[model samples]
Target: MNPTATLVLNNGKSIVIELLPEAAPNTVNSFIFAALNGVYNQHAIERIVSGNWIDMSYSAFHNEKAKYLIPYESQLHPEIEPLPSIAGCVCMGGYDELGLSGCEFFFTLRDCPEHRGVYPVFGRVIEGIDELYRLEKVKTKPITDFPYKNVEINEPIQPEIIRKVEVDLKGFKYDRPIKLPSQVLPKCWAMEYR
Candidate 1:
């Protein structure tokens, strides 16, 4: 089954995501489970780094604390091409010394070509990128005296509230010749030469 759907938030904003189950099965499953179980409901975007992107720390931290560590499922097939971290691109958060990403995730507002091979990108935002851009442009403050220091410290600046994360995998269909959003197609296509 093709993993593709639109995630509608409470603020009337939405994000279309194209999941890569073949590339990152564990990560996809974990994300699906979280979405289906209301784990991402009402979660806020705790961190927002300028030019980098925003981080949904609360959701990730909550998942990690409540759920077991999701195994690292980086791209094993060379055929799966890596894509640029562009605006609306959703990526799994990376572990500090290890390659796996905990629950922390980032939504790219700019084209981050440098992060191609380093991070595991499981999805892309096809809709509501404008809203994400708007959130990325919001003003932020260094959270020094918040109740949750980890949330504050990890996310010194706040971006926008997620409101909720809705998963829709119904009627999603894609052939193997499909190309993912951003510049992932060429990267994956180049794999044929190697």
Candidate 2:
């Protein structure tokens, strides 16, 4: 399928993300379901690691919450061979063998090919990447400090709220229905009499 795109925080400033269904179908489907169900509304970017990515708490604020874990459907398609977790790429959170993380996701700010096999890459920032870059460059100080062991921490940091997630179907243009390339019938199939 031609990947879908979504614009969030529509009040003036917004962030646009292009969902890659072919690369990460499960992750894209989950994100779409969450958006349609109002899961992203009021959700905060809870965690931000400088030069790493921004992680948002999706299930925490949602009414139903993400109760079940979708299997890790990473870069399986040959078309998306060796997907790279580059800057602006949205990826799924990792979990233990139990499979628990529901709402957490990260957006890469640099090419981290090391994470290709470890993380499921689902989407990319087609627009508003400048805003994301700004957020990543923000100066963050630890909220707490412990002298002896040198333990530092921070919390309650507000990045940016996703006011709403809306899919712009008008932006996508797929020439054909999503199917395996092998399943595509030849053009001559329509001229049976020939």
Candidate 3:
């Protein structure tokens, strides 16, 4: 049976995600491991573009802020039929050159055609999408003083938090994902985003 992860927010609201192991084996593995290990505890909801996505598992906002790299599953796994970035779908986040962030994830707010062939859709919301919608409507501001065109800061002004994530393995042994050769992010990220 597919595992389901319930993320309880600081406000007591929860978001339940149905993990698709077959669609994204390693991505799902990484998520289950991270959740069970308390990686998402007190994690910040870093970015939010109203009507776009909720950047939930960004390393930039994680407690460790560690850039744990993993192979981009969508590019490597061609056997599985690719899924669309429809509303409530969850996806891994990363650049093509470096590979996908082992734990970076975002929730699609609507049908995102542009995200196709880029991020792998790994999970779907089974319940409490309204909890995410509440965060979506939050007022956000830029992370930096410089107004760079590429840098559209959607940092929540009131600081949204993920209190905890509990997952039901349901007899599935979700091992840790095979980490990439490197764990650190590229130099470019250090240059600007840090």
Candidate 4:
């Protein structure tokens, strides 16, 4: 089993990630499910913090809330020690207080000591890191919400899309998560917008 997944972006770039199942099994499984189901296709790069990290919340995937909430894998799983968010390292995005992590994931653009021991690191980019930096440096424009009278921040002027995600199971077959949420986003998240 190659245990590698290639993330194809719209910008004519492809990144190969080496999945770390030993470090975070459930997290890896969840990602595999998403990949196989084409949940990550045509997903926009939602947020990017300059010289820091690039956050990806797939439009379709983010629209529905995650059914299963993986535990704090980094803290709970001793085998998976917390590692600094160095360039190309993939990590899960979640709320610790809620004791849940969802589909939103990001890759570090630079060394991020702040995220150490906080986010669950699942994989590392084995190739095409330059593509990661290209996505990170994308020019962004502030979104003005006239009705709400507030500005939405961090939106890219030219949206960078994750065209598709391909996972090589290496003949390893696994079922999807049992509990699939009706909406991948929680009710609380909707309430925040309201």
How high is each candidate's TM-score? 0.68, 0.70, 0.89, 0.79
Which scores higher on lDDT, 2 or 4? 4
Q: Provide C-alpha RMSD values for all models, in order.
A: 11.3, 14.1, 2.6, 4.2
Order of the predicted models by lDDT, top scorer first: 3, 4, 2, 1
Lowest summed lDDT across 10 adjacent residues in model 4 is found at 144-153
Report the lDDT tens digits of candidate 2 across residue range 38-106. Answer: 767766555566777776642334344443455455323445553689988988765534332334567
Q: Candidate 2 vs candidate 3: which has greater TM-score?
A: 3
The TM-score obtained by model 3 is: 0.89
Candidate 4 stretches greater than 4 Å from native? 58-60, 65-68, 74-76, 143-153, 175-194
How do all the candidates rank in terms of TM-score, highest first?
A: 3, 4, 2, 1
Highest TM-score: which candidate? Answer: 3
lDDT accuracy of residue 137 in candidate 3:
86
How many clashes show up per model? 1, 0, 0, 6
Residue-level error in angstroms, candidate 1, position 54: 1.5
Model 1 residue runs over 4 Å out of place are 58-67, 75-81, 144-159, 171-194
Candidate 4 lDDT tens digits, 23-136: 667677777877777768887777777777777752324544333455666445767676667888998776555544546677888777887777767799999988887776
Error of 4 at 77 (Å): 2.6
**Model 1, span 1-194: residue lDDT tens:** 55774656657777778777766555566577666667666766677766667676623444433233333443434566666667677877654333344355677777888767556677877667776766666777775544433443334344355677766666653322211223211111132221
